[model samples]
Target: MVKDQLTQIYTQNELSCMATYSIKAVYHKLMGEQSAVTWDKIVWNRLSIPKHRFILWLAMQSKLQTTAKLAQYGISQSDMCLICADAKEDHKHLFFACSYSKECLKQFKEWTSITSASTDLQQLIRNIQNGRRSKFQKQILLVGLAALVYLVWNSRNSSYWQQSIPSVNYVVKHLKAHTKARIWAVLPKKLSTKDYQWFNEL
Candidate 1:
């Protein structure tokens, strides 16, 4: 290695990849390539709010405490979901497979006119990757995914401690109103009237 460098080589060293390359860039590149399914865009998206992003972070880490996890940790013996009070609560079921969660996600999709092509969380996040969609469409879908996960978790905890759960319609209403407010804040004047109409209908 020393033989290949200049006379001053003994005085200094440098990253060998490229002059402009960075460790952060390499880390992100490696992360993007290592996954069996595409996940970088799913959680790294900027359209979602900070709190929602935090929820996705926990979810990807498998850190959210589903009843099944609690049981495995000896924290609780019951594995049933507090929301549905039927199926055992595991990460997969709590996020997507549970009937109650499915209902919430379904309403969110219907209200947003997204009609997600996949039912499960991972597949749904991947389905939104179609590059043909408008940029705003993609952004909104990503934000919607984050919002649904956060909403389901929030409602579950609320039901657990409050002894009551919000109706699916109520949750959907709140989601729409929140999305509408966010839309106005983000919509740029460069977007055409038609684009504005599309968001309004969403």
Candidate 2:
């Protein structure tokens, strides 16, 4: 049956078939592979919150309303970060380099044992989702990383627009609370006791 299907798939003359295959091969080859960091594989599926997923998607694209982006649109008068007030506010700096954000992220890293989260957005994600980790550990790390991004963006917005950002303690408290709640409510039911124990370690 497979042989018949293959024969039908190449029913045309060899010259025509080869030309057709060559065109498709050339097109894909010309397109090549992207080496840029992509958060897509773990960003959508298995995420517990739609809002968190959306923010993470925007973050991966560097589309958030950091001062640099606002300036690019001719809206922002000051380039200083609303959260940190010292460095220019771009997606990369606002997300991880700001002192305020760094402190908050530090607490989260300590909580989850991911100490190498970088200020570079792509590298930060790579640190969390590398090949050397276990499946359950990777899941925990991805979720924790998303929670950090969401919380960072949220706190930045609050400070930028509302004249207040939650204390670092509050931000960490809320992330752990909301994430733990989501895990219980939405994570796969097949997780074993050891998985549960590992999650607790995070």
lDDT of 2 at 71: 84
What is the C-alpha local distance difference test score of each model?
0.74, 0.77
TM-score of model 1 vs. true structure: 0.76
Cα shift from native, residue 69, model 2 (Å): 1.1
Candidate 1 runs further than 4 Å off: 1-37
Report how far off residue 132 is in candidate 1 (Å). Answer: 3.6
The residue ranges of model 2 lying beyond 4 angstroms of the native Cα positions read: 1-37
lDDT of 1 at 172: 71
The best candidate in terms of lDDT: 2
Return the TM-score for candidate 2, rounded to 2 decimals: 0.78
